[model samples]
Target: MTAPLAPPGLHTTSLDLGGRTALVTGAAGGIGRACALRLAGAGAKVRAVDRDAEGLAALADRARGLAGTVEPHVLDLTDLDAAELAAAGTDVLVNNAGLQLVRPVEEFPPDVFHTVLTVMVEAPFRLIRGALPHMYGQGWGRIVNVSSVHGLRASAFKSAYVTAKHGLEGLSKTVALEGAPHGVTSNCVAPAYVRTPLVEQQLTDQARAHGIPEERVLSEVLLTDSAVKRLIEPEEVAEAVAYLCAPQASFMTGTSLVLDGGWTAH
Candidate 1:
């Protein structure tokens, strides 16, 4: 029998975002951390925003030696006013901060659902509002929303997360439409279960919620619809964000760049 050949290697970009100011929420870890570092690598001054002060500090340490600087801005996304202020003067905005509580709507706490919506949807709206004046004045900007496969598909016992992501999709599109004339582009990067701290915590929560063992959660709950039976890497998703911010993607707006490992193919 003939041996099978390897598939083509994935290619990355060397985008130059020099002299740009980028604000990335949830920049302390996971996809946010990767995005912060990647933007810095492309020569942008990055404002890394997150609630975890210590995590943000560690991220700054790791960001050393990149082509640009990373200024850690420690703040919780729940503070809507502060979130809007922090987004001011940004040439690129990545709304990546979010919270999740997986439970049936009937069983899920209403307060938790509200918090998720506030952080994932409302805060993004405020941030975009803050960033627009600067972008419009300069006649250029990029906004990338870190949505999820859940934004396009529904999964059980994840009412809060699903609702928030779907709402985010709408928010991104609205921003895209409004900002088009001002030389700003808005889009969403929807990824399936990227290996992140949030998702790691979900493994435990999902296990408890479903009464299943933690080990089985990855296969049964997370990757059930993914044709590629592996969690996505944060760097891979970050690369997509970078691509959206690059000059080549200026014409690409009001669209969802999905990195779902074929989860949505069905």
Candidate 2:
């Protein structure tokens, strides 16, 4: 949804934020780590939240190298109170925690589906609700929901993942609409497959299920859907998140920046 135009060069106004706080969920690994690191580099104090305690420590150590400080909070986002506490007083919120469970709809387990929905869809909404008051009161904020290419398009054997991501996109749009007037912006970065521990696990599982080598899963299943024929890099996704949080993006909200390597093009 587009808002009325402001004067030219309006988006470039820098926040000069040296100590502004930001909370990044799922910050211990993959895109979450990258997003937290990028925001920290931009001079924001980061509260890195993830269930993986060891991974969270590593991330906190990494953040020490950057100018901004990072405090790791090991907690499950499924707990609404924990999510709220982790999100409080933050100027930016990145809902990057999610998992992919591949199975035909007919065979998908209800418990697994519910777990995916809880993290991907429900937790994000809860986080936005918790963070909105502080953001609106300050008249400035950014909320970046890390969705997937599957959010916009679907594939076989991933009914639950696709459904949850689609729901996330809708939730982000609604937040954008409601947060716009208060100088808060919400957006989604929908990226194709990236090489991470999660993807590695998926590859192994796919190989076992299809009776093929794990190496083949990349070219046969994953890359086959991408025009670039390569996995999107974590840094690339991190850069997109940074751009969305930049002062230049104040006027950009409720939009999906699709980094699918032309997967949806066809």
Q: Which candidate is the best by TM-score?
A: 1
Question: Model 1, range 136-241, lDDT digits (tens) per residue?
Answer: 9999999999999999999988998899999999999999999999999999999998888888789887898889988889888888898877888888899999
Backbone clashes for every candidate come to 0, 1
TM per candidate: 0.95, 0.92
Candidates' RMSD to native: 3.6, 7.0
Model number with the top lDDT: 1
CA lDDT, every model vs. true structure: 0.91, 0.85
Measured with C-alpha atoms, the lDDT of residue 219 in candidate 2 is: 83
Q: Looking at model 1, which ten-residue stretch has the lowest summed lDDT?
A: 1-10
Which residue pairs collide in model 2, if any?
Answer: 11-248
Candidate 1: the clashing residue pairs are: none
